[model samples]
Target: MERLCFGIDIGGTSVKLGLFTENGNLLDKWEIPTRREDSGSHILEDVAATVKKKIADDNLVRENIIGIGIGVPGPVTEDGTVINCVNLGWGIFNVSEETEKLTGFKTRVGNDANVAALGEMWQGGGRGYKNLIMVTLGTGVGGGVILNGEILTGSNGAAGEIGHITVNPSEEDKCNCGRPGCLEQFASATGIVKEAKRLLDKSKEPSKLREIQHLSAKAIFDCAKEGDALANELVEELCRYLALALSHIAHVVDPEAFVIGGGVSKAGTMLTDLTKKFYENNVLFALKNKDFKLAELGNDAGIYGSAKLIIGK
Candidate 1:
């Protein structure tokens, strides 16, 4: 019988599941709504049920399956004990143990962002590089660090929480985390919009951004591409902070590449180009040559990485 595996990424809204062969080819994928009601107690049961159904529907022998790997949206210890997952209303528990008990399969668990990083390293942008950093710029900034081909979960599973790094102490506004001048305050999608609004409010600069009914990080990048001076300034400012943050990360882990992902990265090459320019300018000489690339796996990175976890890839 052929060896098979299941990769599951549990988010607040939904759970993404992928069935793959031992070599990492995704044979099937699907999702189930995350039942956040009742402290998300129904989540693992739903996942186990779905996995069993998939196996039965596919007529796969139970013994042929290797195990299941899960990516949770919170800090997870090396032993798969999730300290807390507010999004899922979950407290400290051994996710792996519970999942195995429910699914009749061995299980492994990891942080979502860290799992995504592993996914990128295994089959996406970070492929071919053993040391890399993945910075996800969505509603907020999230990061994952890989050193010597392994995820750096840190002693407290907070090793890759790059967004909270303070870049400005004098700023009056506080981040969602209640800190001032965090990297997420300037470089994330929401951060870019916030800065744009602040800039517009502070100045009467005539730019296309002011005319848009609703501003977005993508619009800012688009306007910058069109040579709108104000938009360009915002983009430059955003990149400046991001580059500085990456520089700090470079000095620490010295990864061979930085993989940029998330909604804001949809701006494509310009985003990578500008950020690369700024990163190289700010990075030390030894790290100046590090590569920068956009994430390739898109939303599926988490599942891929989850599978990688149990497959030992």
Candidate 2:
């Protein structure tokens, strides 16, 4: 019989769970509402009940499941204690212990972004690369670092916070973290949109972005493809900041590859090409050859990594 494990990625709006075999093949997966407004314990109760039902409905035996692993969207201690998740309204959660007790299964919990990076490293974009970095550009930017074929969580489990790195320390824009000029302030989709809006507000440049008062990054990209100079400039500036930030990462970690994940990665080669060009221009001469690639697993990487956590590579 093939041994399997359960992996769960918990977000503020929804929770994704998956069942995977030891060999990294995903067997089954599902998404459920997070409803974090309810008590954290109550959410765990729901998760346990849903997982139990899924196993029973699929006629899977307990012996096949080695354990459960979870990726939470917040900072968690090295031992799986959540310090807090601003979006989820959860504070200081002992999530692993709670889930373990509720489900009678051993559980491991980790930072969602870090786990997503691990997922990519184990079976996705960073596969076969021991020294790698993953930069997730969504509403916000997050980062993960892998070194010597292992996840590099520092003494406090907060080592791979590349997004917090300052790309423009002198910029007056304040970050949600109360810092100014974080990488997320420039490279995230939110950052891109903000820059786009700023350009739209200032330029008389013809753009389809002007068609819709509230424009999305996707719309801006489409407009750029249609020859909107302003859109192109905004994207190029975003890439420049990303490249500057990544150069700093290169100077520190010297990873062999960098995988770009999250929603903006959907921009594909356009985004990658710009990032590569900028990194080449900005990074140290010794690190100029580092490959930049898009993340292969998309949004499922977190769940995939969680499964890997239980199955042990």
Q: lDDT per model, in order?
A: 0.92, 0.86
On residues 95-182, what C-alpha lDDT tens digit does candidate 1 reach at each position?
Answer: 9999999989989899999999999999899999999999999999998998888889987677899898888778899999888999
For model 1, the superposed segments whose C-alpha errors exceed 4 Å read none
Task: Rate residue 223 of model 1 by lDDT.
Answer: 97
Model 2 alpha-carbon drift over 4 Å, by segment:
none
Report the Cα RMSD per candidate: 1.0, 1.8
TM-score of each: 0.98, 0.93
Error of 1 at 9 (Å): 0.6
* Model 2 Cα lDDT, one tens digit per residue, 1-313: 9988899999878889998988888989999888766655467877899899988999989977898989887777767788877667788868888999899888988888989998999899898888899999998999888887667777766778888898887889799889999989888888889888788888887877788777877877787777888889988988888888888889988999999998888888899889899899876689998888889998899999888777764
Model 1 deviation from the true structure expressed as Cα RMSD, one decimal place: 1.0
Clashes of each: 0, 0
